[model samples]
Target: MKFADLSSATDYLASLTRHGVHPELDSISKVLSELGSPQDKFPAIQITGTNGKGSTCVILDLIYRRAGLRAGLFTSPHLLDVRERIRIDGTLVETDVFLEAMQSVCLAQEKTGVSLTFFETLTAVSFLVFSLSRIDLAVLEVGMGGRWDATSLCVPEVSVLTSLAKDHTEILGDTLELILQEKAAIGRSGKPFVGTIPPEVLPEWERQRSLRGFRPLLRGQDFDGKWEGETEAGERAFSFSGQALSGTYRSSLTAEYQLHNLLTALATVSVAPWPVSQETVRGALLHLFHSGRWEPVPGFSAFLDGAHNPEAAEHLVRQIQAVRQENGKVAFLSGFLREKDWRSMAHIFTEAGDHFFLTVPPGTNGVEPLTIASYLREQRPGIDCRTGSFKEICQSAFNWVAGEPDRLLVVTGSLYLVAGVQKWLSGDDSPLHAGERTSASPPS
Candidate 1:
């Protein structure tokens, strides 16, 4: 069935929530095959890891565009529009084009008699769009673990695993070793599998690489980066020396952890067939921006970051501590999914903020704000913790931190929560409002 418009198309895709996340690859393979295997039309760089996958994808996209290549990017958990998940030449895919691709995928699914989950359908849509657009390169972010992720259907020219941590434990695995094993499966035999692995899991990563027969380009041993002082314009400056390329670059991204992502992107691009000059890489870094990741809210002394898991929370806490040292009262407006380790995150957050405003994120499985507040109170009786709806909590947090130049409010925990706060702040009343959309459900 053809969708009459973008709204109807999005609604139809959203309705696939009933199918949930089926991690196996058979369904996606069938759907793509029906579409003439568009994913094979162009070379790709596939990225997977517990964290930094999205950032690495965006960085590679920017670098490719700067180098004058038609690049297609596919990343999950869009903050606003579903169309944001698919981009060509650094711009969101046009509505007409998106609808056409969706229609094609729907027709393919009908012919195959296979039900596709939200992520699988979108992945097929991305592949079709990229092929039709004749993109020079495709940067695909695995929606979840790499082994059976829909995006893994392509034999990427380079496979990248950005910093591994314990996340999506319910699906990926509980320990770092198990998680690495799953993510490392994206690597293809004889192709470059470039990324940084924790020292503790080096042996497990080695076993995975040996079994898969992928060429390893491990960080620190084969390549590495050193953080230089910020540029005069406040951009991050770092020097990267690797086996394929060596250069000093600057980035507009603020967080310290972003340096790791930049390194991964550079390494992947350097090894892939794509020929990006050092000058183009330098130019791309200066304009990089990933919303809802340490992004400063307009007209407010606040920032929004989607630090949902314990590892990410630790990064956010480090940033908060740095801000505090610079003389600001740090406060948090946070929410999380029920499946995440909220207790560990809560304990970690205490090192950064004294005031907490809790609210439920959009969609199902959100941890109750009152429940988080009670836990926080039990842990630190003197700490101030409040609970309410997203709007109520945001307003109260704003009021509490306003008018003080040194006071900063951080809205974080889950990307779903960050999206809701961002949409409310921007005054968008669309049905995809973060409060109403169930797009945050885990996608395998």
Candidate 2:
């Protein structure tokens, strides 16, 4: 069946949410095989991590394009449009192009007689688009764990693990060591595996690298970087020293914690076969962009971030604290998926803000706002906590910060929530509801 429009195509994908996450590659493999194995047409650099993988993938894609290479990038959980998940030459694929690719994937699935999940279909579509576009390389971010993620089918020239933390524990594992093994498995036998890991997981990472027989380029050992002071134009300045390359760079992305992601991207490109000059790297950094990560709403004293888990929440809190240092009172408008360690995140957030507005994201797995509000009130007796529908909470948060110039509202917790807020901010009157449980699966 061919889709006549983008809406029809996306509806078809949304319906696949019923299949949930199978976490295996057999079905995607069959679909790709029937479609002429498009993933093999271009070399790839596959990245997997609990956080920062999307940022790293985008950074690498920008650098490749700046160096005169056509790079295709595939990331997950689009903030606004599903087309955002697939980009070629640093531009979102046109609607017509996405629909065409979806048609091909649909036909292939029918011919192969293999059912695919929402993410699996998108993966196949990305590969098909890149192959048809004749991209010089592809930078793929794993949707979840590495071993069974459809993106793992590619034999990457270099594999990257950005950072490890407790997330998707229900599927990956319940401990840090188990999580590391699942993510680190993205490394190909002879390829370079480059990334940074917490000190606690270093030993386990080493064991995984030895077992997989992939070259290890650990951060602070094989390569390292330091953050310099911010530039006058509000860009972040950093210096990188790696095994294959070294340079001082500046990024338009000003989040302090993004320094680690920048360093990871540099390390990945340094060892990859593609050649990128220092000048190109510097040029690319001057215009880098990633949405919904500490994104400031225009003409408003608010920011949106998708920090769902405790580790990411910790990074976000550090940024919030910096704002507080300037006599700013921070307030959070937050929502989280039920599967996440929301209690730990709530604990961290309490240290960042005194006022909270809680709401459920537009999906089945989102934690109820009343439940989160009750927990917060119990944890912090005098804290100002309120619960309501997502839209009501957003209006209340905006009104709370309306007249106080020093009060900053932060919309965060889940990317799904951030997307809803962004659409609301853009004056889209359509009901802000995600169609189904199609993205990441919640724990059983």
Question: Stretches of candidate 2 above 4 Å error?
Answer: 363-365, 429-444
Candidate 1 lDDT, 14-100, residue by residue in tens: 899888778799988998999999999999999998889888898888888888998999988887788889989877888999999
Give the per-residue lDDT of model 2 (tens digit) for 1-444. 888887788789889989977867899999999999999999999999989988888789888988999889998888767888888886778889999999889898889898999999999999999999999999999999898999988889999998888888889999999999889889889899998888998899889988998999989898988888844564778999997668788887778678899899989888999988888888887777677777766666788888989889999999877655476788999998887899899889999899999988865478888888889888999889888987898899999988777889988899999888988887763322121111121100
Tell me the lDDT of candidate 1.
0.84
Cα TM-score per model: 0.94, 0.94
Q: How much is 430 displaced in model 2, in angstroms?
A: 12
